[model samples]
Target: MIPAAHAPTPARRLTVEQVLTGRLVQPLFQPIVDLTTGMVVGLEALARGPAGTVLEFPDRLFAAAIDAGCLGALDLLCSERSLECAIAATTPPPLLFTNAEPAVLDQPLSPHLIELVGGGLPFRQVVEFTERALSAVPGSMLRIAGQTQRWGNGLALDDVGVDPMSLAFLPLVEPEVIKLDMSLLRDPDGDHTRSVCAVVRAEADRTGALVVAEGIETPGDLDTARLLGAQWGQGWLFGRPAGIEQRHRYDASAADLLRPARPGFHERSERAYDCAVDAATPSVATRAEVVAALSRLRDVVAAHDTAVVVMSSADTGLPGVALSLAELASSGRPVIVLDQPATTEFVVAAIAPGRGCAVGLRTSNVLELVTVDDLPTVAVMARALLNRHR
Candidate 1:
């Protein structure tokens, strides 16, 4: 049997409150070096709780915040501190990389930050979002990506290999930099690693997006990063993440190396196509046919761990759809069912980046299937529908 997850201890909850209220979390900067030139190209701000505390480790600190239902608050605190700490460093940063938890990407910034936006930030900021969130919450990811660009910062897809589904989303995210997970560095020659490297290289080749590899402690690991076509790398081999008190020297060429990819960040999305569904298209199959086809689509998409399904709660009575949704949700895909209208009814639809949506409705299908004209937009619309319903 699956065990229940643990909740944060009262002590941990108190630690979180103190950490936020007192601004006790320390920000550490790790140098991202250019592999070829061995220059400090960027500094990624790493956060830590007060030294020697139970919540000193970031993983533990975030887990506690999540359990305490304060992850959004903590995420904002980290992002704001990361930027401010980097700006106040002894040396000016060429590029400042700040991470935002997907949950908090949509939340409003602090008033101080809002005012800072008007005055303009002092450094080039790159916002990193995890690849898992790209697949888990495509709609939220897209909206935040747009807002991030509007704020004049770069967007990065972090831990790219952790979620294979994210490879399909590269076109949609169009990140300025692709940060590879350390697992790829440990076994760069493995089949999974090779496949991920190929996909990342393809995106980089086509779009000129910069690639930075993590967990590089050895010169041999540096070679592996180059083999993966990574232009920049970060890990202990260069230097472990350090506090502002530590004096770190950076090369003037750091921004020059990454500037070419900046345009891709500010450009419009690459995939362009219409996703509107017309009910009278006359191609939609009968209810049974749609159920069988969507079942097949579910089996395929579930393997990729992609697709977010949304439906009206009142429509689950359809013969095969409810069972299919159960399987989809079990596979760890999102399946949001909104409250049903008094007289409204629809069938099932599954929208994902990989395969075009499948299934059509008799009257008003929950999410109608469509061709690959533009699957990402359909997924966003699906999420927007759920948000509106909420």
Candidate 2:
């Protein structure tokens, strides 16, 4: 373990008069990166020490800040200092993420403070709001939300899956991003975490919020998060939190970080037609022939890291269609039947032909599969089909 000196100290009890002096404020930075690309995205501003004490964790420091009635001042100071430091560095400004208690946000900071930092630095920044603190001041949530929106800084709802109370604030705050805590992701099969993640994902989809799975520690954790639809990920698996002066350069070119967790289906969907044209034999109509076509198509999709699979089959009226596994199931086809030769045409028609339902498509699926190359054309085709049938 790192020495205790590196850890943050809790604030000594101080009078409200002492709080305004801002003497106790010191900001530390924890780097956030793109898990897929391993590129440093930005830093999370964490509070460090008050002159003397033995506390080292950010959580304790923040709690003491609240108790000392200096949380607002501390938050503002951290935001200002963190941004200034990032600008001085040669690295391109990544989005600076900071935590703001709802109580702090409810208090109005001089517009000049926001203007000063924003004017001097690149405006790519996100302020994460702690859900527990927000819940404590329920009546003022909307006001805080409006202020954050007006400040031109993006808002993120943090600690999403840990507390049940977070669900109540989702509609009221309408944050631009939602961060799922690592604890929730520990067990991929845990119903509570999965259910909460599903709800959070749905809210993100509805509001166009970016879902970030925070505190990722292992490859398994990363995989589970991606499978559950988190577009962005952060954790020890990516990088650990280093001190403010530390210049950490994340190598963004690592393919594992950039590659989608499920590449096979998405890649196949993108080049479904191409794979079909190249791999399928003309005279074959057996189950093995169809399975081989699917397998080859899966390989093509995997190469591109896509999530949807399209195949051409001779069974149904629609010879060519894309079918997501979910759609195939919902179409009332038995799993056995779906694996049978006759169901291939129906599956393709449902998914590829842009059938009546938008059942199986997901945003993560789109982001993983749709590249600059052929996304526009594929999108046009999908939309045309949706519109034509609607």
Best by lDDT: 1
Tens digit of per-residue lDDT, candidate 2, span 35-106: 566666567776655445433355666676687777777667666656665666566345677776666655
User: lDDT values of the candidates?
Assistant: 0.66, 0.50
Residue 229 lDDT (model 1): 86
Off by over 4 Å in 2: 1-24, 50-56, 118-120, 248-390
Across residues 97-207, which tens digit of lDDT does each residue of candidate 1 receive?
A: 888787666566777665554456666678888876654555556566656677766778899888676676665566889999999999988998998888788778766
Stretches > 4 Å off in candidate 1: 1-14, 64-69, 135-138, 245-370, 373-390
How much lDDT does candidate 2 score?
Answer: 0.50
Q: Best candidate per TM-score, number?
A: 1
Clash count, predicted structure 2: 19
